[model samples]
Target: MSPVRMYTTQVCPYCLRAKALLKQRGVAAIEEIRVDQDPKQRDAMIALTGRRTVPQIFIGETHVGGCDDLVALDQRGGLAPLLAG
Candidate 1:
């Protein structure tokens, strides 16, 4: 499986939902970067994803975006293939 990484905060519902979905999809591990504890990381997340959202997710090198985007990708049959890589 591709490496899964997510920029998240402590109290983000979207982040939790995203994690649950990824776990259901058989993602065993997730590298979670907490932006709430570190201001620099939040800035880095914005620079990387061009958004100030809580859950900026990355499946390997490809940015999978936030919770809604991830759900859309799965609904469209793209998440499985991407995760396989």
Candidate 2:
């Protein structure tokens, strides 16, 4: 599987949920970027994803959006393949 990367904040429940779901799907390691720790990282996230969301997920190079988007991808059988790549 490719690397899993996420832009997250300390108190975001959605970030926790997204991490859990990814873990459940066998993602052993996640390169978590804590935007809460650094104000500029949040700006980088928005610049990269065009969204001001807590959990901006990326499976390899694919921008998977937030928690709901991750769940939807799994439901539609796209998550695994994306991860596999």
Candidate 3:
């Protein structure tokens, strides 16, 4: 599986959902960056993604955007292939 990373906050349900999906897809480890606790990281996230939201996810070096985007990719049968890489 590709390396999974996520920028998340403490109380985001979407973040939890996104993580659960990744786990279900057999992602054994996730490099979770807690942006809520660190302003510098949050700023970096915003700069990289151009979005000020929790649950900014990435698989390998590909930015996967947010929870809804993740779900949509799975629905379109793209998630597994991305994970496989």
Candidate 2 matches the true fold with a TM-score of 0.97
**Candidate 1: deviation at residue 34, Å?**
0.1
Model number with the top TM-score: 1
lDDT of each: 0.97, 0.95, 0.96
RMSD of each: 0.4, 0.6, 0.5
Give the alpha carbon lDDT tens digit for every residue of 1-85 in model 2.
Answer: 9999999988999999999999999999999999989989999999999999889999999999999999999999999999999
- Candidate 3 per-residue lDDT, tens place, 1-85, comes to 7999999998999999999999999999999999979999999999999999989999999999999999999999999999999
Models ranked on lDDT: 1, 3, 2
In model 3, the clashing pairs are none
Which of candidates 2 and 3 is the stronger one according to lDDT? Answer: 3
- Quote each prediction's TM-score: 0.98, 0.97, 0.98
User: How does candidate 1 fare on TM-score?
Assistant: 0.98
Show model 2 residue runs off by greater than 4 Å.
Answer: none
